[model samples]
Target: MSENLGTMTDFSPDDSVMLKDVLRGLALPQKNIPSLYFYDQRGSELFDAITELPEYYPTRTEIGILERHGAEMAAALGPGVRLIELGSGSALKTELLLGRLEDPAAYVPVEISREHLLAAAARIAADFPDLEVMPVTADFTEPFDLPEPARRRVERNVAFFPGSTIGNFPRGMAADLLAATCREVGAGGAMLIGVDLVKDRATLERAYNDAAGVTAQFNLNLLVRLNRELGADFDVAAFRHQAVWDEDAARIEMRLVSTRAQRVQVAGRPFEFAAGEVLVTEYSHKYTPAVFRSLAEGAGFRVARTWTDPEGLFSVQLLEVPGAAQDSSGGT
Candidate 1:
């Protein structure tokens, strides 16, 4: 563990870039906002709360898979591997993998929020004192360099992308991001990812539109973020959170619909909204094993193994590059 916990590779997007992205999205006819912006300190906290809700089954279910079969997942990766986790919020599930790994080289947690990333890295460092904890403050969806660990001889780099965060991107973008991750981890490396399986429409809809309304708050916080950071005057109360399962798209679309006709100014620019108009916030796509295997293969990875709960609500898959040896572990 590094004594200077504050030290990290910082490639975080600047405010000017964020303003540009927001403006560009607003200019589109569909009116969308990039989901990456939903991880400011407050938004991150809200999301942590969301995972605890009864309706949000992905987190707990994935954690259960990790707890039950994490050793096998680690064994499939072999030893002295440098673990890189994308969108590693709190990293509660990662501890299981780390504890089971044999003499791991280092742990790199890439996240968008600096505060949350650092706090989680500090805790991991304290608990795994012998392991190197390197935190990177950047959007994992984009290209960024991984910091080299000083103390260990790394055998390989394995990316841990959990919580079905990959579902946020459309199919094309998700494939591209996986390709980029493949490049980051190099030829012989692998990726251990959590993927949400396609299930009943009712259960999927309930997961996003929770009874506690925390998911609603999580969706609305994006506007609050824009208001505070970009000097936007958005009547947060004038909009209502909505989550609709788009059957054709096989995704849950999260949006903010205007309650009434209104105009909002962001970064000194005006945007109009009709009473029933919606501004898309995020999309969560579900996949079956075959569909996900195609998606992974398109990104240059071979599905080595997959572990799922008995109910098959979620899966934690190990995907390896061609140079790595394939494990014969069967999927549940």
Candidate 2:
């Protein structure tokens, strides 16, 4: 096993996988391992840079909308609320919301990275001396309950799920995750969600596949991460980054394509990759307005109001949980 030493700035390609099960799953005849694993410290930093690219409109556009309408959203929801955020990255755009919120009692940031969660929470605590910071490290996709500390706040809860994190989930999983959040916070709570809108293919494609090749490195770095953490032997030059538009599915697929046939041993097991084998990393599903609303309603949320950028490139929707109805018949 060769030890690859370099950062994403030097990211090449490889055929490694995360856990043993993950490697087996990816090597399956037909299966797509998740890309969320790509979000190591370096990968996260690269993503932050990706957001700053001029071609990436979602981050800036969403921030702009928040800056203009954050106070309005706070006022619409009332004051002294507990703000819970899911998948809080750097929380860069969220300062716009945090600064404008109606004197939140506590700010809870949920993240998968322990280092990031603690760092972001510490910064927020120092910045907002008046507000309390509660950081939880857990995967938000599954039906896992919020932490004990999080559940203590029985007051009016307001979730700040910024970034296009919801898009990371497929339609079914998205609805389930939203519903789970609603259930956790209970009725009279609020969920402020950021969603990317469907747009022209060229613009969308450019955002993920940047000219500086940063996005490519970010995608390919997943293998690097696996190799470093797991005992795996993977040739970093055997694969390439692939970003394709799946118009039929209305989503963008980011995959790591095998440049040539290669055999890799990971997690105490050996696996083979065909010359054209692809590891489907991530699928960012775009949403139409009507579709999002229908999803929220289906998940026991009342669409209160939404803020969209001038060009309609992105949206921030505030949903009231079970406003006046919860027993209404819908999907399970």
TM-score of 2: 0.88
Q: Which portions of model 1 show Cα errors greater than 4 Å?
A: 1-6, 324-332
TM-score of each candidate? Answer: 0.96, 0.88
- List, residue by residue over 1-332, the lDDT tens digit for candidate 1: 45734378899999998999999999999999999999999999999999999998999999999999998998988888889999999999999999999988888898999999988999999988888898898877777777777777788888999999989999999999888877677778899999999999999999999999998999999999999999999999999999999988989999999999999999889999999999999999999999999999999999989999999999999988887533221110
How far does residue 139 in candidate 1 sit from its true spot (Å)? 1.0
- In the range 68-186, model 2's lDDT, one tens digit per residue, is 89889878867667677877878776678778877666666766666666667777777776666656665555434442222233356777888888887888988998888777667
- The true-structure Cα RMSD of candidate 1 reads 4.0
RMSD of 2: 7.8
Candidate achieving the largest lDDT: 1
* Runs with alpha carbons beyond 4 Å of true place in candidate 2: 1-21, 143-154, 324-332
* Residue 310 lDDT in candidate 1: 94
